[model samples]
Target: MTVPTAVLLARDDVTIRRFAERDADVRRWTELDRGGAYLALEAPELLAADVRAFFGPLASA
Candidate 1:
């Protein structure tokens, strides 16, 4: 699924950012290592860290 970043940026009511799983494939396998689409299930702590990083500043606002 492609995000319309240009269209989204043209809107004034939203803030957006993109996170790319560069090593992940459609089936969620990592190209260079053992990882799957079930990241939250496989790596809860890592997922939590990324989520916190994304929203942490907003919480402080």
Candidate 2:
């Protein structure tokens, strides 16, 4: 079960663990709003910042 467009990782284990705990809720929310999912749950700029924050190190390295 993977969201191809979603890169959800954190620099620390705790953050990853916490986010992992909410995986089910996110999935349910996505399912509940199929139309929103199709259109993207967040705006492009917000999503770019989030992905950059999560994968900054990888990108720089």
Q: Identify the candidate with maximal lDDT.
A: 2
The local distance difference test score of each candidate is 0.37, 0.39
In the range 1-61, model 2's lDDT, one tens digit per residue, is 3542333432221234346545633321111211233223544454456566555655665
* Cα lDDT of model 1 by residue, 1-61, tens digit: 4321111121122322323323222222112132345655666665565556555655676
Estimate candidate 2's alpha-carbon lDDT, on a 0 to 1 scale: 0.39
Give stretches of model 2 more than 4 Å off: 1-42
Displacement of residue 9 (Cα, Å) in model 1 is 21
Off by over 4 Å in 1: 1-34
Clash count of each predicted structure: 0, 0
